[model samples]
Target: MSELDAAVAAALSADGHLADLLPGYAPRPEQQEMAAAVADVINQEETLVVEAGTGTGKTLAYLLPALLAGRRTIISTGTRTLQDQLFHRDLPLARQAVNRPVRTALLKGRGNYLCLYRMERTLESGRLENRALADGLQQVRAWSGRTRSGDLAEAPAAASEPALVPRITSTADNCLGQECPLYSECFLMEARRRAQEAEVVVINHHLLMADWALREGGFGEVLPQADVYILDEAHQLPETAARFFGLSVSSRQLFDLARDIRLEQQREAGDAPGLSEQAARLERATADLRLVLGDGMRTAWRTLERPVGEAAEALAHALAEGIAALAPQAPRGKGLESCHRRANSLYQDLQRFLAEPDEGGQVGWVETRGQGFYLRLTPLDVSEQMAGQRARHGRAWVLTSATLAVDGQFGHFLERLGLDDARTLALDSPFDYPNHALLYLPASLPEPSHPDFAEAYLQEAQTVLEASRGRAFLLFTSHRALQTAADWLARRGHHQLLVQGAAPQQQLLDRFREAGDAVLLGTQSFWEGVDVRGPALSCVMIDRLPFGSPADPVLQARMEWMREQGRNPFATYQLPEAVIGLRQGVGRLIRDASDRGVLMLGDVRLVQRGYGRQFLHSLPPMPLTRDPAQVRAFFADQSSTSS
Candidate 1:
């Protein structure tokens, strides 16, 4: 037997703290093979893309190999939830089970650490909110005295309040950096130092991308080299990558920095000129931008240059004058210096866009989404950046998700990752779909584009929700449709409503579980990584096929780029993206083999449109039915049997 295989066998036979690793925790044949395959990849220094299906013990499969690889490994997860689980629960147990002497560390983004400098500034200034801010500061003061790691999660009631949280938090823009009084004891710097020496470092995707974006230099930088990198919950990478590579500077940031400066100066007895005037300048810039945007119902994105119309030009000039006035008066310290640098950089960026419009990159504006405004510039496609960086780093990169494959191939993913020489792998889920889930497509609904679409979709949803006895998640492709269905369901008043945005997502989920026979109305965020096992989630209702909005700036540019290359954007780009999104939505239904549920898609285009078959083929091969009664019958059978 190979050395890696022998090591795993020894660990499997050990007695340890891991509850899942006891004698009762026998691995299924497929799980064993997956674990062995993961080991082989690490030992041979080969890139792998293994899709360990849910319940295939993928976490253990990779964690064991990572420990056995006997090298510095960096494990990055797509979400904070999974990162916490791995560091707190999985990794500790895996270490004991394997009985290794490996040293490890958990490193989250800088925002997670208590910014002692900022906290002190807020406390001394006394410009913070009210009694709640006082109480929060008191907690931070007490916790800071005893805490070693400096991670904010150590504080009780930290995550509950965002307002109180931000008052004590520090950002790269406002950090004191090397000149700060607390530089020697800086939490962020300490975390990075620990990460560099530790054998294994745990981080999230955003931090990983931030490291890539900033490279190894600049404020709050990450450690440089790693032997292996494993990313869990890989499905969220595409959108996350898009967001990190995109650029947008908000007016709120300027306002916050000004507020911080005014407060800090008042406490420190230091005279900083132009603080009030700078704040006003930023406020005026915001107002000018708003006036240009107006309250128009329709919004359009213009190329950075190309005369943003006359009104946009006026606003752009106003912003330029205001920023220039404030740039000279910024604080002289390194922290404020960084802020100044960024401000000057943004000013130059705006000038370039205004003067040279087609500046050979992606630049667009999104609605400030509120009374505030936001103008942005982002790369058209991150594929080249991602692929080039990974290839240049010369590390084995593995991208795995249950939904990565489109039509039994990885071309879409390969193209996006810009990987020509990387290896690929795919694995099927172990669940028996024929018995566990049913793909129910309604025959009576009109086309999605029809005027009667919302009502027709809601009617089918009502039937399915009734059949499942309100143990259903009614997902909508658009927020408008979600609100419409929510209003209709509220009027009907048949089941308890646990809608999104009414409460925190986890709280809403908790209430949904508590109220077993209830309906949940959520949009895009609910489509993935939402686990409601057992009978709590017996049906999933998708209002329409998930597709990227054609008018979206980034997606539109990518589509145009693909078309220019003699490629069919719909077939090459849109279809695969939609398929992956659909799979994520549908996969939320059947989490475990014993957990049975019905999936209802209200969009009739799945049958009418030729591309619909491509989407359907990506889903689990479940028994398909167009009859609504048959869906009702399956639930009835489950109810009867349960009773």
Candidate 2:
């Protein structure tokens, strides 16, 4: 082994320093093997794609190697929640265990930091319409003076007073950059400077993908190029990448532009009546466009109703009028000049959507959510763009997650990111899954296509809930199914039911743990990145095979693109994606060495369909049973042993 490889192995060994530092430490050969692989790639300056299963202590397995190699590294995670956990909890613990004094910095999107110039401008405008908003702004103003990092996450605004977030934070469209009077004291700039100097930087996939698409002028401020990149939760990277590698116009962007113009008019263009009137007209036009787009619609541009096309034309006219009025006010002040530039950019973006769909893999589509609508010109596939990112940055790369492989194969993931030549590794969890868990598939449920499928699944799940008591997670493939199940359970009033949209995710999770016997119903968001050990979460029920919605505009475009290439989309694309998703939802059970639980798949297709064998081959080695009596007996044995 090379020097760095040896160091990582020794640090994670049974008798190493990490043993004493970590409580309830359990040494597993799988973790050591994974760490050695990571270290070898870092030393060789190569790319490594790895999947380390649950209870493998993956955070430490990759973290120790990155620290020992002593290279400038960028550690990107799937979400801000993971970003904070890695930076605050994992990084500090690893540093103390290994005795390394590495310089570390945690960076997030620009919105997370407090912008001093924007806060001052908001105060000067005196636009607070309520006492709560004013009090929240005042709280941030007082906290800003003492905050060294100005993360806003660190500020005392009782969750940063979310209502004042837009008022206090700066966006790329409004920021004046080096021209601002407070350029030297800018929080975002200072954070970037620290990242440039630190040995290791923690960021999320959103910012990483944004930087890869550096020209859009979104949150695409390129981070300091690094010697190494370690992307944890790598399964989420492709979806995040798809979002950034597209061009779009949104109702949100149009409304925000109008609001900014009004603010700039109040400050610098007070004498220009035409400017403010045009801004008002732009907002009204945007509202009309959203109305015609209709709610719950996501389809290609050509398929939209005729009214939508007309509203887009009126919107274009209103936007042109806005640019005409703002052109004369461009010389008034920096803020006004920025607004003028933004109005022109927004107009150009909307023109792309209004025109015919462009060639070269570009798929024009529109989606309306609530009162907001988005028009996107997205590439059907981003493999070429993703390949370019790997070539541009990092001497060494490590992409890892719990669900990167399906049926012992990495072809689907590698082909998606154009990393076909990268070395791949899969490590099984050290926990004894065979003895600690059981897969309960009821033979009685109807097809997921049936109209009464939700009702049938819940009726069958009533017995499993009784066996495991009330601690269970009812995972659904669609929001409609989730609502149906929630309504049925709420009417029963048997257990403390917590629905996903009823509260914030973190709050719901916190309440679930404390309640110990509550049943939580959730959709896609609850499929992964959740951890609950012991009997508090003894059962997991999935209502259907988690497949990508055919209604998704992007997915539809991709399916069309695959057909043009003469490829079987279902076997190659959809099946693998669904397998990984099912694994993620099933992973919620049996988290620790002592943990025990049962997984109930509500869909009968797992056995009725031939492709079900592939999913079985991908999951852990847990005994499967179709009888409810076997499941009840397993839980009964556990309860008897505990008593």
State the lDDT of candidate 2 residue by residue for 1-643, as single tens digits: 7888878878987778888897867678888888898898988889999999998888888899999888999999998888999999999988877787999999998999999998998888888779888878888889889888989778864426655787888877778898898989999999999998999999999999878787345444558879999999999988888778888888877887898899888888789877879989999999999887778888888777788889999999999999998988999998889988988988998887677564578788888888889888887778888888898789899999999898999999999898966999999988888888899988888888888777778888888998998889989888888898888988888668999999889999999999999999988889999888878898999988888988777777788888989998999899999999999998888788888889998878888899999899999999999999999999998888778
- The residue pairs found clashing in candidate 2 are none
Instruction: State the weakest 10-residue window (summed lDDT) of model 2.
Output: 213-222
What ranges in model 2 sit over 4 Å off? 156-163, 215-220, 356-358
Q: Go through the candidates in order and give each one's C-alpha lDDT.
A: 0.74, 0.87
Question: How does each model score on TM-score?
Answer: 0.91, 0.97
lDDT per residue as tens, model 1, 597-620: 899988888889998888888788
Which parts of model 1 are misplaced by more than 4 Å? 9-23, 129-142, 154-160, 216-220, 264-272, 294-300, 303-339, 352-358
| Residue 18 lDDT (model 1) | 42
